[model samples]
Target: MSRSRIVIVGAGFAGYRAARTLSRRFRGAAEIVLINPNDYFLYLPLLPEVSAGVLEPRRVSVSLAGTLRGVRLVLGEVDGVDLAARKLSYVDPEGASGELRYDRLVLTVGSVNKLLPIPGVAEHAHGFRGMPEALYLRDHITRQIAMAAGGEDPAESDARCTFVVVGAGYTGTEVAAHGKLFTDSLARQHRRAGSGLRGDRLPRWMLLDIAPRVLPELDERLSRTAHRVLTKRGVEVRTGTSVKEATNEGVLLDDGEFVPTHSLIWCVGVRPDPLVEETGLPSDKGRLCVDEYLQVPGHPEVYACGDAAAVPDLTHPGKYTPMTGQHAVRQGKTVAQNVAASYGYGERRPYKHNDLGFTVDLGGLQAAANPFGVPLSGPLANAVMRAYHLAALPGNRVRVASDWLLDAVLPRQAVQLGLVRAWSVPLESSSPETAHAPAWSGHGYGPDGNAAEKPSQG
Candidate 1:
């Protein structure tokens, strides 16, 4: 008999872990294939550090091939799925087409950026989801501060120095917190170099959210701690407010107030990948609906997990698991076990994970955390946060730790590589978590026009 083939889609935390577990358990027993747009897995939790110039991009990009010993890495994005025929079509980096047939399929396509219909936001704002956006922001922030020093108009200089970040989740909070430190350091450097800009004039950063408080979804204790740290770091936290419109000049808040800023970062939440719509299957919200076994109902051969799947929280009875890495990582392992059981290799089990508390890194030696429901703050929280991240990362421990140590002692190395440009990192990218060129050519990306191929890989 031919060897059973298992195809796993995506390479985020869940998909990566699934591939690794299946490769080890099946060994030569099955043909394991992992398909994704990039060759490496992005450690998304540290992305804010990338944007702040505190960590190099490569440090967070874990190579899928290096870690998955028995799996074949196929680089491309799956755009279409034929459920009845058990086949899928994808477009490669060179925009070429290909197909794959599988006996068992794992769908962990992950989530994309969430957008609201605010005016001018699609054109003026940029999101912080993937590697390219972080790189672009790092360079863009540095350039804005440096060039503002040489400009003749003080208003324009202040506008250039000002930054507005939307959403107050962990991503937005960390970006604003670390972002202030980064721009402040640059301002000092300019003054030391006699660039006319005052070192003492700190750049302005405004963090806006429609919620009642920062980290509104987290524990109240965490919310208070994060709010305190951001305030101490000079971040203007605007709660119970939202952007009404975005323009080249600045943003208009719903309160009829206007603020001038050259930078607008959209860190709102995410939805399932667009590919979910093409599947022709029932979905919860936008996510592919799957049972506790991670299998799509009525399609035993199809399994889904991670941010793309709406898996029921058996522990909570009626609730679905939130889009988070906490559940996704454990769900991946369960996917492997269930798939094996279907082949008479092991016993299948339902996905059940207890709620662990959350953690928010506020940059520097400040953080808010509720581990096992025990809330902690200040340096103790920071230490626990760092240790948690180090333990969670699959690889690159030394490089990431070394970067952190260097950042503690030396100033951040801020230099624009000019690899990523403005035209590449648009705010309205169809998939917040993925990148593509404008028109996508044969690749099938959409109308907003982010056509640079360099970003699509990440």
Candidate 2:
């Protein structure tokens, strides 16, 4: 008999872990295949450090071929799934199409940027989700500072020096925190190089969120700590405020105040990949609905985990698990075990896990963390945050650590690589895995000439 083929879609936090676990447990008993657009699995949490020039982009990217010894890696973006036929179709990077048939399938395709209906946002703002965005942002920041130094108009220089960040969640807060520091360092370098830019004309960073506090999903203490650290670092934290409209020149706040800025970063949130809904399976707010065992209710041969599946939170009755890296990592392992159990290897188990805690790196030696219910702040929290990331990274620990040490002592090299351009990473694009050209023309009007309906935040 032919060996059973198990196919996993996506190579994110959940998919990567599942592939690793299955490869080790099944050995040669079953065929394990991973389909992903990229050759490496991106470590998302430290992405801000990459944009801030603290860590090289390659340091956060781990090679899949080198790590997954026995798994077959397919380079493609899955576009269609035929559940009854047990086959899926995908298009490779070069636009070639292919198909795969599997005995068992796992969906962990992760998520895409969450876009709101605010006018001009899709055209004026860029998102920070994957490697391309990070790389583009780093160069953009450097170029802005460089341009501001040579500009003749004070108004233009001020706008170029200002950065407006939307959403104050984990990604948004970190981006704003690290961004302020990055721009500040750039300003200092320009000034030291005999540029006419003065010390008082430092970059202005504003963080806006409609929520009452930063990190609203986290504990109150953690929120307070993060707010304090951001304000201390000269970040304008505008709680209960958000953008009403965006333009090439600036953004208009909901309160009717217009703020001039050349950069508008959209770090709002994410929703499940569009592939989930395209499956036409039972779904919970765009996420495929799965049982406690991580299996589709009517499809025993199919399993789902991570951001793509709405798995029940047994710890919290009547609720689904939050879309977080912490839960995604654990669910990946549980789904792998259950998949093996379906083959009569062991007993299947329900996914049950308690909140371990949360950490927010506030740039430099300031951070906030709640580890095992113990609240920490300042350098202690920073240490905990760094240690946690180091321990969690599957590869390149030494290189990441070395980057941190070097950043601590030396001035960051600020040079624009000009690799990623403005039109490549539009905010309305559904997936970060592939770079889609801007779908809107002139302003923020989408293809239908109407703002896309906002999806529910998980």
Best by lDDT: 2
lDDT of 1 by residue, 1-458 (tens): 36999999999989999999998888878999999989999999899889888889999999998888999999888989999999999988788999999999999999877889998887788888788888888988988888888887888889899999999988999899899989988888888778867547899999999999998878889999989989988999999999999888899999999999889989987878878878989997889989989999999999999999999999888889989998899999999999989998789999999877777878888888999999999999989998999999998989999999999999888676766666567776654444545544664444655443423211
Relative to the unseen true structure, what is the C-alpha lDDT of residue 284 in candidate 2, on a scale of 0 to 100? 91
What are the models' TM-scores? 0.95, 0.95
lDDT of 1: 0.87
lDDT (Cα, 0-100) at 443 in candidate 2: 40
Candidate 1 residue pairs that clash = 113-432, 437-450, 437-451, 438-450, 438-451
Candidate 1: segments with Cα more than 4 A from true spot? 432-435, 438-458
lDDT of each: 0.87, 0.90
| Positional deviation of residue 6's Cα in model 2 after best superposition, in angstroms | 0.5
Which window of ten consecutive residues has the lowest lDDT sum in model 1? 449-458
